[model samples]
Target: MHGFIGEFFGTMILILLGCGSCASNSLKKTYGQNSGWLFICLSWGMAVTMGVYVAGMLGSLGHLNPAVTIPFAIFGLFPWSQVVPYVLGQFLGGFLGAVLVIIQFYPHFKESKSEEEGNSVGIFATRPAIANPVFNFISEVVATFAFVYILLNLGNFTTGLKPFIVGMLIMVVGTCLGTTTGFALNPARDWAPRFAYTIIPVPNKSVAEWGYAWVPMLGPIVGGLIACGLYTIA
Candidate 1:
């Protein structure tokens, strides 16, 4: 129960800050409007760092992402018994965080032209820059594999430095690989918010692109599992 609460709020904070950054950059009439990819990537990195810190404080493993949780469990780093609870917390937290984003940028949602331009969905979920599922899936798998692999090896770091380093890793990955499919390396991060976009009535919202949703969701899970396999072999 304690772990569930921590994971829930930790993932919530992750999306709150991460998606909040995207909304600020994409939505009109915001201070961060048009800030470009660099700013968004940096903010998301910090979001991960903050979420980890908060989860750690609550005595949770701080696996705000299911990609992280699954790999850890498969590698025996996390208990298999707790995986369901952690994932459920993550998905719920992500949905709630996206809801918060809608509320935070209510005026923009009502007034912004992005919705009409068919670009409003990007704020809530990742979209491919090139729109090729095969390549996009590959990108997500590779990116998430690297992310989970690096994370599993970082267990030796002191608590204070671990989150910071992890944040840097995310920032680097986003800067380097995000353009391909916006680097939706965490399934919970992508799917939950996308689900929210489908249910919530944002003015002139797109169709939620359900066709491509499976790429981000399945790719990350597969990648995380592969990382666990490799880690075990090592």
Candidate 2:
């Protein structure tokens, strides 16, 4: 129960702080050029670090994202039988985190483009300026590959420093690719917030693009599985 709750809470904080900062910065136009990516990567990395420190001791540290959890299960780092609980915890926690962000940003909800405020909200939920499913999935696959590879290698480091490296890697990817697809390396990070965006009111907001949403969700899962398989064979 502790592990499950810890995962739930930790993931919530991860998305809320990391993605929340990205959304707020954009809404306010406060960041300089490329600052959004930098902010997101930094925030996400820091969130991971903090979440790990808090829950690693309790055994739920690695389940912070489905990308991490699913691959771990594939590689036996996490038990295959337990995969369902961990994923469910992560998803639930993420939804809760999105709910909290909505409450925190309630005043700005009306300012959003949607005429009817939806339930979910966050900056990390990516919406392409233009729809390009193939390119988007490719971007997510590449980004998730980078993320999981770094986790496979750097995960051995001391807990205190591991998160920083993770953050830096994310930062680099976002700097290089965030403009096109928002560089959502984690499925939870993208969908949890998008779920919120759908329910939250934004004035004149565009409809949810379900067609493009699956790319990030499936891409990262596929990328993580591939990396884990490679790791096992190596």
Candidate 3:
């Protein structure tokens, strides 16, 4: 019960703050409007830090991303029995967080009349700077692999200064490796909110682009598994 509640609320805070940053940058007539990529990266890093802090305080290990939990489970770093609940919490919380963002930025969504003006799914999910499925998949794999691998070495990142260190790592990853595919190293972070955008009403919303969804989803899993394999081996 504690794990479920912690993961749920942790992931909720992750998306709420992270996607809120995206919306602020992309949506028109906002104070943070047109903020650059650095802004997005930094905000996401801080979001992770906050989420992990909350999750730890609430009793979970703070695996807010399934890419973290699932792979860790496969490697015996975590228990398989907990996988389903953690992922469920992540997805559902991410969805609700995104819904809250829509409510938070409704007027901004109305102001941005077209995808060109930044009213698009990119605010909630990732999109490649250059659209190439093969390379895009490669990007996600490489980025997520780097993220999860380094994360494994952190030794209980949910505690003390480690969460902040984890945030810096995320920032570095986003700045260095994320520019290619928006660095969706977290599958639940991408898909759940994407689903929300597809089903919910948002002013001048763009297509959800489910066709490209597979890259962020599968690539991160594969990469995380690879990281887990390598960590156990080395």
Question: TM-score for every candidate vs. truth?
Answer: 0.95, 0.83, 0.98
lDDT of 2 at 159: 71
| Backbone clash tally (model 2) | 20
**Sort order, lDDT high to low:** 3, 1, 2
Candidate 1: list runs displaced more than 4 Å: 114-119, 156-158
Predicted structure with the largest lDDT when compared to the true one: 3
List model 3 lDDT by residue over 1-234, tens digit each: 778788999999999999999999998899999889999999999999999999889888998998899989999999898888889988998999999999999999999999999899999999999999999999999999999999999999999899999888899999999999999999999999999999999999999999999999999998999999999999
Which candidate has the top score in TM-score? Answer: 3
- Model 2 weakest 10-residue run by lDDT: 113-122
Q: What is residue 142's positional error in candidate 2, in angstroms? A: 1.0
Q: Residues 67-169, candidate 2: write the lDDT tens digits.
A: 8788878788777776777787777777777767666655554454442332123354776545788888887787787778767877553276776666676
Query: Clashing residue pairs in candidate 3, if any?
Result: none
Global lDDT of each candidate: 0.85, 0.68, 0.94
lDDT of 3: 0.94
Q: Which run of 10 residues does model 1 get worst, by summed lDDT?
A: 110-119
Tell me the spans in candidate 3 whose CA falls farther than 4 Å from its real position: none
